[model samples]
Target: MKKVLLLLMIVIAVSCKNETKKEVKKENIIEVDKNYFPTELGKVFEKHGGINTWRKVQILSFNKGEEVHTVDLQSRRTVINTPKYSLGFNGKEVWLDEEVAGTYKGNSAFYYNLYFYFYAMPFVLADNGIIYEKIDALVFEGVKYPGYKISYKANVGNSSDDNYMIYYNSETYQMEWLKYTVTFNSKETSNKFNIIRYNKWKNVNGLILPSEITWYKKDENGLPTAPEESATKFTLPLISQVKLADSFFEKPKN
Candidate 1:
């Protein structure tokens, strides 16, 4: 009877210890799922539209100023159609309407892509190769905004040299000011940075997008110390289109 009691006590202790360990593991998993795994940018994506939703969307269509832009988010394919020029990239290849006036090969491809990228915010920043870090609240236009700095690993894209500082509203978490380096040509990380203020935003199919994006050139000191104080660069009105066919991005036979 004594031996049986000892064995039972040992079994009970072992079972209880195992249960406690499992509970600890469960807590750890919950914390990781909530915090580190998703990332700060992931939180922003959830605010706009969950990454899964954007991933499920095969195509995103929009208009910026005079051009109609359609993007295949999954395939990374993009099409920019304007009255003057049409450029298409099927994720792997970028095609431009050569017969149309003022279409250069890589230049057109780069420009079309750059425009689309800036227009599609928050989500575009959620890309795989991006590294994000929380930065001190930015003091802009005499107002303060919570901000984060985003950089890319080498070979992230055509220009990994680029870096972005994005500021968000403290209460709403919507984006406000964006400062980015335009180093598309040089591999060096040292490049002049530009600023764009997100004046307004609109929601399309659950995707939060900027409606009016105002550009600002850095001051003579090469930094945007204040809002709208620097020479106002060209401001573009952004628009959105929806559900375009893949063939729209394909080259047409002239």
Candidate 2:
């Protein structure tokens, strides 16, 4: 009887140890997932609006001059309409319709989501398949801004070789500037980076979004020199929890 009792006690102890180990392991995994983003960039996302909040967004729309651009946040379907022309990506191909307007001039594939990516900034950088590295600080005028360099994994996007650098105000943790390389339609990557300044911002549905973005002329070293006379600006920014129907982004029939 004594031997049997001892054996039973030993078995209970071992089972409890195994259960405790499992619990600890599960907690460690949750911690890792919670902290997947680098510390600094994580703060940026929080300041803009938590990354999780941005992820929950189903649709986002904004206006650039007379053009209304709407994007399906989850599927990356996009549609842009102006008085003269309309274009969109139906998840598979980029289509342009100028029947009511006129002829379209720019490359449809490249321009489809260009502004959306730019407007979405720091939050978009949190997307999967992106690798982030700490980079040197950028000193513009007299202010010093810290930044991170972002690159995509192989076969991630239209241009995986393209690189982006995001600079933020260290004190506020708000993104202030962005530098990106144009590798579209190129087999090889380029080192030249064009800069855009994000100074004006507004809050829409708890997310910090750009109201006006300034483009600057590049110097000999390809860094921004002076603010361009014509800056790309946005208005009527909105975020929706409801996604548009798939047919909304489909090619228009005419």
Candidates in order, TM-scores: namely: 0.73, 0.84
lDDT values of the candidates?
Answer: 0.63, 0.79
Best by TM-score: 2
Q: What C-alpha lDDT, on a 0 to 100 scale, does residue 2 get in candidate 2?
A: 26
Positional deviation of residue 240's Cα in model 2 after best superposition, in angstroms: 0.6
Task: Please name the candidate that would achieve the greatest lDDT relative to the true structure.
Answer: 2
Q: Candidate 2, clashing residue pairs? A: 84-101
lDDT of 2: 0.79
Deviation in Å, model 2, residue 128 alpha carbon: 0.9
Question: How do the residues 120-239 of candidate 2 rate in per-residue lDDT, one tens digit apiece?
Answer: 987889888987777778778878888888889999989899889899999999999999988888857888788899969899879999998988787775556789866788997867
Clashes of each: 4, 1
